[model samples]
Target: MTRPPLLEIQDLRTYFYSRAKEAFIRSVDGVSLAIAPGETLGVVGESGSGKSVTALSILGLVGGNPGVITGAVHFAGGNGASGPRNLLADLERYVSLTKHDGRIVAVAKDEPGWRAHVERALARVRGKQIAMIFQNPKSSLNPFVTVGQQISEAVRLHTGVTHASEAKERALGWLERVRMDSPRLRFDQYPDGLSGGMCQRAMIAMALASEPSLLIADEPTTGLDATIQSRIVALLAELKSEFGVTTLLITHDIRVVSRLADTVAVMYGATVMEHGPARDVLAPGVEPKHPYTSALLASLPSTQTNGRRHAVDGRLPVIRGEVVDTMNVPRGCRFHARCDRITDAIRARCMGEEPALATVAAGHRMRCHLHPGEARGG
Candidate 1:
């Protein structure tokens, strides 16, 4: 029997609300995608294109008063004993404690064995089943704590290891796995002492210590030198194959996506403009259906026009005409303003109609009015 996709996100919109302005800043608007078991899905975009927000939304980190997240992030993987299970069906069970009116409240739902259910579900999933590697290792790691201690804490928390020695040994083993030299020596070192690359390796070691089924890597190579970046990406590729871990790689670097991702999703202005196999989407001599995707490709340093490198004309659009406010996104195609391929014939349609994500090729999806029919495989 075939297994279900590891993670499925549908109609996901994460909007940040400002009571004073009474507006919702759409950080991630109506994004949908899926990652199969052991498959890598790359989300690429400019700095403010909501790639990190999408990852945060999936991990249930986009909740609280500042942000309102709507949609489903169904992660289907657990223990592997009972096949895959939908972990998001009722997340309320994971809420053993919630704050109410500035007071902490313990809610057991007044049902039989409710607390047990919440504890069991919370322990079985989340950090144990799905792990995330955030960008900027220095920020992600606690400065006060030793790297080994942090990794040990995570291992102990997720694996329920009682002995500190056991956790330390496991942490040391993971440090070695990430190819950190002298794992034993670095185990007790503080984050301040390690270089950026070593810090990233430690972050990776901590993230993979739990052996999560789904690994969400958010710009794993950020703040690193070019040589170190290549090494980290190669390490991720090697580890993924070794552990059979499915990945959701979120990065602004298209080069990183092209190197590591099997499938790629191009994001612009809080939405995905195109998604397909990375080879077809980013390969040489291939034209993408979405104008936004094409513009991004043209902006790449590799793109050449008569021996000179090609660069995209025009500046990136500022949503809502303000630096802080991203709520007032333009109607219709978000890319129409900066699009180089727009024609007078379709200008009205591009400006007035919101295009749905349409299939333009086998396994390739594009959000554009120019391609409105069913997709055919190459």
Candidate 2:
């Protein structure tokens, strides 16, 4: 049986005003995704494809004028809650918009009022119910405090281990759990004392110390050495198996997604192009895939050999054309400008109107005119 989604995002839109451009940068435009209980959903895309922005929007962390204009992030609490709570409840009351030719031209937002409401709504939920591990471990960590103390603070705050001695013990236990070498020595060390890999391990330990029901790992393996990245991935794999914590992993690395995610969402031009089970969506030479997904998979440096992947000889295939610009997204398919598979039959439709995310196969969805007959709402 299919389980109810633990985190459901419906038509989320996050925009940032650019004074020089005299317009809003649609960082995350009309994105919808869901993660079931104990499932890890990996969102993969290019650098400017809005992967990180979607993660930030989910936690209500987007900043700037008129941010998060519309959306619903429904999170099902793990503490015996009756149903999923809409984190963006009553959002329309604080913002007004002016539309010109069916496009947003101006926005008036009560920033102060909205901020206060968000804080109130997420007071008991942000760190306790959902924890996030940001990309930069050193920058995210407190520079002035010892790593162990920082983790102990989180343990005390969320896990009810109030006593200093007990909290410290629990913090040490987490350090050991993350496989930190010389746990005692590392406990007293500050952020600067640890290597990039070790700091990442510490960050992971701190995030899991709270035992949050949902973990959002945004580019967790980024900015690390290749060897360190593999180790971090391995550790995360182990932790996922041990804890069974539901996760939303955002990254540009297909390898990381292949290793960690049970399901995948491919984002482009600030929107999802395809979403489905990892095995099907990431499979090489797979049919019925969106042009964007096929291009991404084709760009990989490895090829299948004897049922295993190995490095190839020649230069990797490159997807022609630049990534879509979000400031002025195209009217039709977001990837139409760069798509290589547009046929004569679908050319007009692919250029005239945006295609909805339609079912192409069981448990698989794609947004392209090629699958017009299966059109359905995202």
Top-scoring candidate (TM-score) = 2
Per-candidate local distance difference test:
0.76, 0.87
As a whole number from 0 to 100, the lDDT of residue 179 in candidate 2 is: 92
- Candidate number of the best lDDT: 2
Cα-based TM-score, every candidate: 0.83, 0.94
Q: What is the Å distance of residue 352 in model 2 from its true position?
A: 1.4
Residue-level lDDT tens digits of model 1 in 287-336 = 66577766666566653343322433653332222222246676778877
lDDT for model 2, please. Answer: 0.87
**Which residue pairs collide in model 2, if any?**
none
Superposed model 1: Cα runs more than 4 Å off: 1-3, 80-123, 303-325, 375-378
Q: What does each candidate score in C-alpha RMSD?
A: 6.6, 2.5
